[model samples]
Target: MKPNLSLRVSQHLALTPQLQQSIRLLQLSTLELAQEVEQMLDENPFLELSSDDGAPEPDPQAPADATYSEATNADQISAGDENDVETPAVDTPDDWEGDGSMDAAVEDGEWGGDGTVRSGSGADEDEADAADLARSHESLTDYLHRQALSLRLSELDRAALRFLIESLNDDGYLEDTLESLAVGLAGADDAEQLDELVHRFTVALGLLQSLEPTGVGARDLAECLTLQLHAMNLHEEGDPAVVEAALRICRQPLDLLAKRDLRRLSQLCATGEEDTRQAMALIARLEPRPGRRFADVERNAIVPDVIVRKTGRGAQQSFSVQLNPDVMPRLRVHDIYASALRGGRGGEGHQALQARLQEARWFIKNIQQRFDTILRVSRAIVERQKNFFVHGELAMRPMVLREIADELGLHESTISRVTTAKYMATPQGTFELKYFFGSGLGTETGGNASSTAVRALIKQFVAAEDARKPLSDNQIAEMLKEQGIECARRTVAKYREALKIAPANLRKAL
Candidate 1:
């Protein structure tokens, strides 16, 4: 064996901590960025919000102009070779602690490397105050526990019921059966105890089924439906004959009900089609996932990063894309703290303070960069999608991330980060940044059409369709073909489903 040595030259990129943070900030939605701003303010003492209470009240337009400049600067900085594979700056720490990536974010800004940030002035006008919707919701588990508190039972019975309550899934279906639960409890206690636990669970099962949801702790879909029916039996809407008919229909195959096979259902229930139809209507009103409504679902606000408003009238009309002031945090280094940090103080504490000061400056700069990238991308998108703004979605052309990346001299991934979670408000209303990018379909004129445009066409056709004789997917495809779209029936069906339109039979009036 022999070993040979040779000198080789190659280039690769390493993402700095600050660059990574900038990328993350770029992708975060408006609400998330605000939360990040609040967190940084709390964690970094050097960082403080810019305001006009004690400070001198400046011109309202000052922050807007300042924001423009900051965004421009960031765009200028990152408008480099975006395709550099080794551009490892996209991998920075999420927070400003430890290595402090914020330092790496803004190289030449107001901070000027010495890390002294001049406090900013007033807020931007476009930064509308976000509508706060905070409500304390009672979770499914908590709701069950509260009801359990009112029940009178022995300790063992309550324990077993509580265990069963805990075992129920989010949809209020019991994932584990009493037999299985008893088998698992067998190892924990003697046979007599196991028998007692089984008996208590059996009794608890009936009581749990009687919860307000009417289907809280059932074993399967059939059981869940049966529990609801049982509850409805005691209600004012309850019809004894209807309940009897429904019970007979439910006891048969589930597949029959799903298909809505009216004649077959009537035959199976030994009733007329009219009776079967009424019984099925009762089932339709039943809540399948009773606990779903109580889930603590966090509803996010859609605050647009860019606002595109039309300027000029008639032939001179054009859209102007600018940053939304509400989302851009009016931030700077605390003037008092920055002045103190600038004074030549020497100590271990002094170095730590200096680091914190730098972090604050970096945080401000990175946030600026994030908005800058967003603005640049949005401007480009507006430029490409002007037809869409003027003529509706049918005028949209095929676009990909790479096209914007090439035009802006940014990496494809950087473009993706800018588009994700970001939104634009325009004359046609607000839409996601990624919504404009769609695959091309060949046109009869040797041009390409946006899949988005095709979807829009499908939506229009369905909206105008006659309910008495709804257009099937095949008919829709034919209509598209007449317009030189060359659409297949399957494609029309897919677009129809994506738009949440039902099938022809489903759309037909009964």
Candidate 2:
């Protein structure tokens, strides 16, 4: 075997550190990006937030020819693909990424400040404050403990109750047998002691079950429902007969209730079909996961990357895209540090400071490029999905990453990076950028319809459907066919399931 050296031209892509940072920043969600910025601010003295007032003002200390100015240099932009890992040769002036600066200026304005493309700011501070409360919700045990304080229980009983409360899972289920908890307190050395411990546990269990949620400390689903029924009975809630019937139903195998077998349930409860239906309805209103609300149900702390707003009214009505100032970290280089480094008066620290200064420039420029790419992509999306904005998801046209990438003169991967974890707030709702792109479905007129539109249509059909005779997937497919869309029964089923709609049998009202 011999090794030969030959001259061959080969092309390769390298992910430089700056390019990698750009990609990372692009993919981070609004909240995550804010978190990353805070971390960077703490770690790097070079990076600091630009004014919250919306525009990156040129540093007063900077010379007229400073490389790190308000706007990036056109020549440098042409040289750095900003994305070819900075390949300017393939970039066009019309492309968003070409100049490495945002074409549209993002002003700090309220969400509903301007109609079709723009929506009201649903993420106001009040909602955020409420969400913050939810974010810091107390554990179920702590909640139960507070409720226990109002009761006049002995110290031993209160301790046992607290222990029981702690033992309950986040879902409020007590999975372990009383014998297990008893053994922990009363060793296995003596059966009599264990029996006494079990008796005390039995009493504690009753008090624990009496908690506000009604079903807390329930051994199983059946017992949980029974405990709730007894509480309802004590409070004289619901029709006496209906409450009685629900208790009887709960006492039976829970699987029968879950299957929604009205026939079997009625037969087992020895009640008529109508009575069984009423009983099922009452049971349906009960909360299965009692502690779910108390659990740290982290509400998505979303701040949109792009905001679409309505500009004009009537015939002149148009939507414009802009970066959200809230999500876009107003970052600028630290003035004092940059000036000292530039003056060359900060001796021995000049080299390290210079590197940090350069890094700061790259970070700010990359961030600027990120927003510009996002704004351009958003504009193209708005242009393509204009009908969707006007008429809702039903009018959303077919779109793919390739279409946007081709239109913007960007690689599909770059488009993907820009779309991932990035959200845009529009009149309809705040949606991830990827939500706007969907594969096409064939139409009767040899055209194409967005799968999103098809799903929207299916949702409408299901919502308007009769409860007594719910539409099946096959029927839905036939309905789509009537509307000039070619969809299969299985495809309809898939979409139906995606919308979290139950099957026809399950959807049918008793």
Candidate 3:
């Protein structure tokens, strides 16, 4: 049977190019969004950065409802205008007589002035400098090379040392064995040359270990600790008996030290219980990671997208939620260019330029929508978790993406996009927007307790636990049961691990 074509009418959802861009922009973190804006500014001639003086003054006659009151800065775009691309009106060429260039228009105040974004204030600059210090930090290799310059060594010894220095991992561990390293350096299968290279590497390794970072060039955690212990012994930094015990303990299996098996460690190290305890404590004080300080810390830096401030007092207490001005990119359509494109006579390139103008408008509109959606979602979170704002994470209530999505008349996916990489600066601390949402646990009162709150409670119990008798996961679960929250031992253990807390056996002190 052959199929025949028939007239049909069907309706299905579709994503326009502008809608796709909006969705893409919504999911980006503040840093990513800034980079995207910079790229668009470079690619599209119609787009430019709005200067501080370029922002339009608020009209005294305009109704209060027309502007967004939550924003501290007047340049903030209103969230209400979803359909309009609120661009400043461009003047016709007849209105101003000049060279007809963007520079001339900016000087005459016909469009945004200078198109130069101002640098952040002094406090912001200081914070930025601190952040830059993390990004521009000296690496472990560079640090070692700087110290190497002072060493009075033969050229061959220096070459060997440099080769060894380059072989170190980020943790300052020499993962490859001396044999393998020598084989790599020898670049030949000759036994005599391989043996000579191995000897050279051994000498270089000894010289490298004696460098200032103390434990650099270690092959394993045990070796790293032993090196630090030796350094401490040389400096007379600790008790002789304790240092010796610690050195002995480092030689034994590390699992015993990790489990805090005081009896086993004392037996192995041939030291008294008190001396073993002191040794373990001393081991804990030593730096296991020689390259930790030099590791790039810039990856951990966070730039929050929203700011929440506490307002009023007592019964009138409230919180003001606003988009972070610092993270918002000041962008606008190049008014003179747009006006010229509109006023010019028809030509082959005119349509392409018009398309670019429309793109710029759509970009501005999409950017506004992105921030607007974030603000709405953030406000919804602040409203629901107000108790958390006042009383900390322990007071956080159970929440889900659907709740905010329903409240804002947006899809759950949109809510997820808004929360994913976006951060909020609150009275408690800066938290990712998704941090406010967590699964719930049932309570005896027929209510739900947020998993976040449960984790916070578990953290509190652990903090206040007796050092001699730390609480176990089972005990913690029982305590939660007594508090009317039904949490199992495994759940408590999972939360404890998520908080990076050690287990009871490991936490126990002598």
lDDT of all predictions, in order shown? 0.72, 0.74, 0.78
**What ranking emerges by TM-score with the best candidate at the front?**
3, 2, 1
Which regions of candidate 2 fall more than 4 Å away from where they truly are? 1-9, 50-142, 163-171, 174-204, 292-298, 342-350
lDDT of 2 by residue, 1-510 (tens): 899999998655544466567777776776777788788788888777656344444455544443333223223222211122231122223323422222132211211110001111223444354356665778888889999999898887888888888899988999999999988877888999898778777888999888878898988888888888888899999998999899989988888988899999999999988888999999988888888777765554455777677667888777766566455555677766665556686556787777666666666655656666776688789888988888899999999999988887777877888898888889999899999999899999999999999999999999999999999999999999999999999999999999999999889887
Mind giving the per-residue lDDT tens digits that candidate 3 earns over 337-385?
Answer: 7667667988879988877766775676567657667776788898899
Ranking by lDDT: 3, 2, 1
How high is each candidate's TM-score?
0.71, 0.79, 0.81
Model 1, 257-347: lDDT tens digits are 8777878989988998887878887887788888877754445446777777777789988776666655666676676666666676789
Clashing pairs in 3: none
How accurate locally is residue 209 in candidate 3, as Cα lDDT from 0 to 100?
99
Q: Name the lDDT value of residue 158 in candidate 2.
A: 80
Q: Which candidate, 1 or 3, has the higher lDDT?
A: 3
Better of 1 and 2 by lDDT: 2
Write down the TM-score for model 3. Answer: 0.81
Model 2 CA lDDT for position 487: 98
